[model samples]
Target: MAKPLKCDVCSEPATVHLTQIINNQIHKIDLCESCAEQKGITDPSGYSLADLLVKPESQSAPEVAALSCPECGCTQREFKKTGRLGCGACYETFASVVNPALLNMHKGDSHKGKVPQRALERATFIDRLGTLEDGLKEAISSERYEDAARMRDEIIELKKAMEAAALED
Candidate 1:
């Protein structure tokens, strides 16, 4: 067979898959037959490829105009495109749209606060682990194997704490 078309969003080969891409990011839109089967999503009425590709008229969709602030009704496409907001309230106003877009653009690394406070604590632990890892690298470069080993232990302990806290969260 000829080369398959790559997914426009992920730039990966689009093998029995379908999704929505906006601004060079992908969102799970509709599952193809194969993907739905893989995901164990069986609709009683059954869904066709057309059902996935064609949005129904009854769905109240947001306006796709990039010129206006999706949250605050601010008309500034240039700032939005560049990923900078004009005001503090922009975060609150556009949070719904902004968070997901930011998460997708940043590869699921954006702060989504639905998580518990313990997750924040876990994150701090991860940060501390990172510092320890960095220190270990520096110590090793400076011929301080002893300090490096100490930092390695600290990092291991910190990582275990982070994992435990994450499970609790």
Candidate 2:
């Protein structure tokens, strides 16, 4: 078996492998999915190795080109080319594309920065409280009075637990 080729640009495991014979000479190019898409080699034109290997997920070139950040007017095509965002709003506007890239780059979507234990606990408590409150409202609206009462009790318990935790700190 032959050794797998890496992408010419990013060195990622090449999914798109192209071979061309010119002037009685054989030449080959290897490209990973992202680099192939970045180079516009994934266009479904004629025959290309990328077309056979990399399938686009949802958005086509036209749709991606059409996407633009409303705040800074940064086009998705520009973002793909530059790999930079124009503004904070671009993160939200281009989340679908950006999120996967972020995961690839950071290995996680959210920042897991070092936080004080108390702060982490507080944040978790707040998040749980908000979720319970929303569920409580939904239960009430749907006339699930029992569920609502249970959630309400849960919320009170959560508040008491948080209070005890704070007192300990």
Candidate 3:
């Protein structure tokens, strides 16, 4: 005898299956036809999956045409329409426009990606110290003395913390 696939929402025989990958995690959902219809998943004229994935800034494509990546010659309008960047330089070129959208999509602007348990603390401290150092250098180069001083102090503190952590380990 074959076992029936049940809907996650209502326990009715599942007629549709959906898979979504979010933040490197796979999420699966099963739904009966009726439940799927109620959720508008079955609507032929409704929003497509790509439409759902589009960022809010991408909704107004025409407005973005004026801003284009110098390196790849990729217009913001093209990025909005395709939801993909043309080159690595696109990130730097479009940073101002993309940062807010990225912040809305993720927890923060900085990448706090997964690290192995064995080296987590050291890796984290090193990453933070590196970022602070970079900021310090940029501030100094830009002649922002107050901001440079603050970044320098932060970097020094991070280095001290890293040393303490290493001693404890």
Candidate 4:
């Protein structure tokens, strides 16, 4: 027969196991469910990861109250409390307040990262084809047949390149 795991706190049979790494060191804890709840580790109403990430301690209540999205009427205070934006327009409305936090979280303001090498050619061709198609539509609407024809040819070439890349995959 195997021995039951002992709880670290009270020597009771443990029902929960937790592992954490702090300062490059691994730490393990064994706890009964009740002890885990008492420590806030298993609490349903405890502070969530979103709350911790979005709610900066530097901002005051008055500042939060004054900031709101013009389109959706979602206040910064509401976002802080709920850790979510009301709509996509809220991003533009609250860009000044959120940009710094976003930059910090993503380590960059714009995406200048690398894509998978295998799909690079196909992805580039598809993006260019989309752009060309949009230009072709604009040209046709403006009654510029020459420009529209050029854009259509470019789009066809890009589609051919995409197909070739797909076959090579």
Candidate 5:
């Protein structure tokens, strides 16, 4: 009784559905037969997710070399010649020029590195330590010496535990 899904790219009646879960978020993509085939959905070996994700730019504009990053003053021509950017902001400024090369070189645009379990645990401990320190300051300002003492003791214990973990690693 439900209506069929439409293609995400072409708005046609979708025949193919792909769901991707990244960073605990669900991303759904619906593609019609023609669009799916054109995008190489049928052949896993030849599949290029970048082709579907990055829209083609207009070829009419030939003045891309004139483009420059507002933050670092790096020009497209300079990037093309040096193969590097002046600063972090140049990435966004020259994305149109850089994305195609990135797809060809890395086969993907994003980094998919795995975080170490210990690193995750350490990060959580650091965050909790910061929160406890903030709470201790608040308790002291509010004239609650007992609560402050308890938080201070907890903070010392957490620091010792974190140090022990680091030593174990």
Candidate 6:
């Protein structure tokens, strides 16, 4: 028998799929892919890093606030104040400073968005579009008509799925 179904959006095990969030003491309801896209929302949340880009003269460290690496002679104050590291070792040596700054700017270490799916079909279709389009580009570059035909079919299938997802909105 096939494995039990799971909510494709959130990677949770469930026969039924759902997408929701709690904001302002109220829960945002589940929306299919098209619905969510039409609303420009995602299941996962995201934050802007505009604040991280701030450079106030007052917040700047003192003249002797430099942190020099013993081995590479890199300074911690330079990295923190300017938000630029000279070498890859800076990531390991000064993680404390780098991590919090990133968290403050991005709200998380990674910036990947957790988009909610108000409609699942639309998400699937958009995914398919990427694969099909890439495959078609590759086949055309290699002058392969047969491969192009296969990509065309995949695109058609994706478009159909996208249409179905849109109807859910």
TM per candidate: 0.33, 0.35, 0.36, 0.40, 0.44, 0.32
Residue lDDT tens for model 6, 42-131: 435631121122223355454324456655767754554544567767665656556554553344765476667664545666777998
Model 4, span 18-87: residue lDDT tens: 7655457544566688866756676677543234334353554566547778788997767867767898
Which whole-number lDDT from 0 to 100 does residue 69 have in model 2?
A: 91
lDDT (Cα, 0-100) at 169 in candidate 5: 89
lDDT of 6 at 134: 93
Residue range 1-169, candidate 1, lDDT tens digits: 8976543224455554445454675644333445455434465754433233222324314443333554556633434334356666666655545554445335563455587677567678878878898899999999999999999988888878777766775
Q: How accurate is candidate 6 locally (lDDT)?
A: 0.53
The Cα local distance difference test for each model comes to: 0.55, 0.72, 0.69, 0.68, 0.74, 0.53
Worst 10 residues of 5 by lDDT: 51-60
Cα displacement (Å) at residue 142, model 6: 0.7
Better of 5 and 6 by lDDT: 5
Q: Find the candidate with the highest TM-score and give its number.
A: 5
Q: Of the candidates numbered 2 and 3, which has the greater lDDT value? A: 2
The TM-score, computed over Cα atoms with residue i paired to residue i, of candidate 1 is: 0.33
Residue pair clashes in candidate 1: none
Tens-place lDDT digits, model 5, residues 1-169:
9988777677799998876554575545678999898777888685443345444434315566467899989876566455457998887877876665455335476668988899999999999999999999999999999999999999999999999998998
What candidate 5 gets wrong by more than 4 Å, as runs, is 1-60, 70-74, 103-120, 140-146
Q: Which stretches of candidate 1 lie over 4 Å from their true place?
A: 1-116
Best by lDDT: 5
Question: Which residue runs of candidate 3 sit more than 4 Å off their true CA positions?
Answer: 1-63, 119-169
Candidate 4: regions farther than 4 A off: 1-45, 53-63, 110-120, 123-163
Give the lowest summed-lDDT range of ten residues in model 3: 47-56
Q: What is candidate 5's CA lDDT for residue 47? A: 46
Please say which candidate is ahead in TM-score: 2 or 5. 5
